[model samples]
Target: MSTAIFRFYEELNDFIAPERRRCEFTCVLARAATAKHMIEALGVPHTEVELVLVNGESVGFERVLDDGDRVAVYPKFESLDVSPLLRVREHPLRVTRFVADAHLGGLARLLRMAGFDTLYDNHFADDEIERLAGVERRIVLTRDRELLKRRTITHGCYVRALKPPQQLREVVDRLDLAGSAQPFTRCLTCNAPLRAIAKADVVERLPPAVREQHTRFSTCDVCRRVYWEGSHWLRMRALLETLGC
Candidate 1:
């Protein structure tokens, strides 16, 4: 059997078993295999890998492995401009849009609150998610590694955090989205952009206290839900502040 040493860097190691994390481990292969297959076999999805180095030279995912090769795999470089290097993806996404799986609804809402174009449907099937990612070029966010492994999903991320708040921080830090946050610009419930509405036009819909206390308001064009700065708004603003967005 052919043997090779594999090393995964940064968050990519999170997918590996505890025994194989953060260090080189030998992998025995029965036949010649592409780097992409081998990497996925070790539990790291190809979508999460930005660069791969074989025996000190950069290689693409389709590179064939040889005996005694040393493979180094890296996660996406959010802060670095490695455009000249060999990367698995053809190009980095120019716009940051996302499609969240069923389990990430809370995180999706948080993303919407930050004014990102996020699409989340708890009823979305795996096939539907894959189709949306391909058609709309939206990044798929999910806690499921296997979902990111789908061949059709070109742009995706394996969310590492559990809590909605922590997940928000993880996504923001990973994508460097802090500067792009436009809080309250989108409908957190429906993922539609919000537009300013005349207070008098929606006065009948507002409660007595809100109608008297607030003048400025925005409405979701899709859901027609009115939003204004109230106690809930203050709480959401505080949450955004804590997230540094």
Candidate 2:
């Protein structure tokens, strides 16, 4: 029986039981296994892995694991660049688009408020979410471990937090998206891109005082929902800041 040493780094540690973090683990293999297989077997989703170092050389998911291999896996980097060090595989897709599972509506709203293209619906079945992510190439974000385990899911995250704020932080940090976050760029009520609209265009829909006090206005391209820099925007901005966006 051949064995390998695996060490998961950074947020990937969250998938492991507390007792296993920052420690070398011995995994025995009865047959040849790709790095990808061993990684998921250890509970880290393949989508969350950005870099894999075998011994000291960078390799891709298909890299075969061998006896005595010292494997180190890391999540997406938030500050550091390792492009020059990669032996194979390209830099991770940096687009902030996401597709969420049914149980995470609040977290979905938070992501939308933070200006992410988050596709969410309470009625989405696990298979539908997986299919959408596969077809659209959106990063699947779900709390369901079984959903993340689906082989069809090429890009996905098994959200670790129940609280919406914590889940937001976990996604931001895991994807190294802090630098790309754009708060208030999307309609909070709808996932449509907000465009600046003249006050006169939406005046008919606004309250008398709202039209009188708020000159600046925006509209959702998809939903035609109106927006302005009101108390709600301020509260959302506060939430964004609290999220370290």
Candidate 3:
């Protein structure tokens, strides 16, 4: 058996046992266990971990443990650059496309409203989500810890907030999405790009008030739904602005 001192930083502690949270604790490891094995054994998903440090030295998850090792596990760094030390993965997801599980439909719609390409279906199975992550390179966003622990899921986020609005902010803040966000540019219901449609083409379909009050309009090609600058759009714009998108 190997014994080591372990400390989890930031949101990583959410997955660990309550007693071990925000505190350094001793742990026993099996023979020849690597950091990846040890961490997952402790209940923290490997995908949630961004960096691991042993004895003040940055190490990858594959680093084998020693009897006297000291391990510090941290979630993704928000501001401080640890690019030189990142071993779990070298770079962040360049394209932040996401595939949310069954329960996160509200968050998925918010993401779509913020111009993110999001796929959501109440019937999406865990296996399908895992496959999409590997085949399409889409980030898996869900509150399920076990789902994020899958070996095939290399990119993912464990959403913490329960409310849709809070969840949206948490995801945006954690992923640094403000600069990349293209609010109101995508169809929230159909998850397709919104194109500027000629008002004449959709004029007959518009309600009397919409036709009288609004000249700016867009439509979803997939759903053939007309959009206008209305109260709902203003509310969404406000929400995105608060998110710094």
Candidate 4:
């Protein structure tokens, strides 16, 4: 049987079984396998890997594994420039859209508030979230480590923070989305882009004071929700600024 040694770094160790945690582990196989396959065999999903080094040489996911090969795997590095060590894919996407699991409704709302296309539905099952992520090419944001470990998920991230606001910043920083911030341009209630609407068109829907006090307006194309710069807008802007968006 052919065998290889693999050592996962950082949070990746969370996926390995208790017996193999935090150290090099041996995998016995009948024949050569791709680095991606070997990684998934070790319980970490291929999506979680940003780079792989085999025998001190950078190798792509499709690289064939050889007997006695020592593989080093790294999880996504939020602050590191890994372009030089990229194995299979080119540099990771600078801005990544997200699909949050049902439990992250608040985070989804925060992402939406930040003008991101965040897909969220409380009734969606974990499997459904994974499928939608694959189909829509969205990154999976989930608190469930087991769900992130699935082999089918090609792009997934395990959010480290529990608070919704912190989770939003975590996602943005992790995905290098600081430069892509476009605040107040999306519908927070639905993942729809907001369009400028004339004040007179939506006047009847607004409160008397809102109509009298504000002239600039934007409306959600999908939900038809009207929006105006009000007291809450300043609070949201402050939060966004604090998050480095």
lDDT of each: 0.92, 0.83, 0.92, 0.84
Position 77, candidate 4: lDDT: 77
For this target, which candidate reaches the highest TM-score against the unseen true structure? 3
Candidate 1, run of 10 with poorest lDDT? 28-37
Give one digit per residue, the lDDT tens place, for model 3 in 129-176. 999888888999999999988987999999999999999999999988
Candidate 3, superposed: residue stretches over 4 Å from native = none
User: What TM-score goes with each of the models?
Assistant: 0.95, 0.85, 0.96, 0.85
Estimate the lDDT of model 1: 0.92
Across 91-139, the per-residue lDDT of candidate 2 in tens digits comes to: 4445758999888888889898888999998899888898888788788
Every model: Cα RMSD to truth: 1.5, 2.6, 1.2, 2.7
Deviation of model 4 at 10, angstroms: 2.6
What C-alpha lDDT does candidate 3 achieve relative to the native structure?
A: 0.92
Clash pairs (backbone) in predicted model 3: none
The TM-score, computed over Cα atoms with residue i paired to residue i, of candidate 1 is 0.95
Residue-level lDDT tens digits of model 4 in 1-245: 78999889988888888888778889885466889877887788777788899999988888999899999999887677777665555444455788999889999988888888899999989889888876777889898877876756767888888999889888887777777888888899988999999998998899999988999999998899998889988788899999788
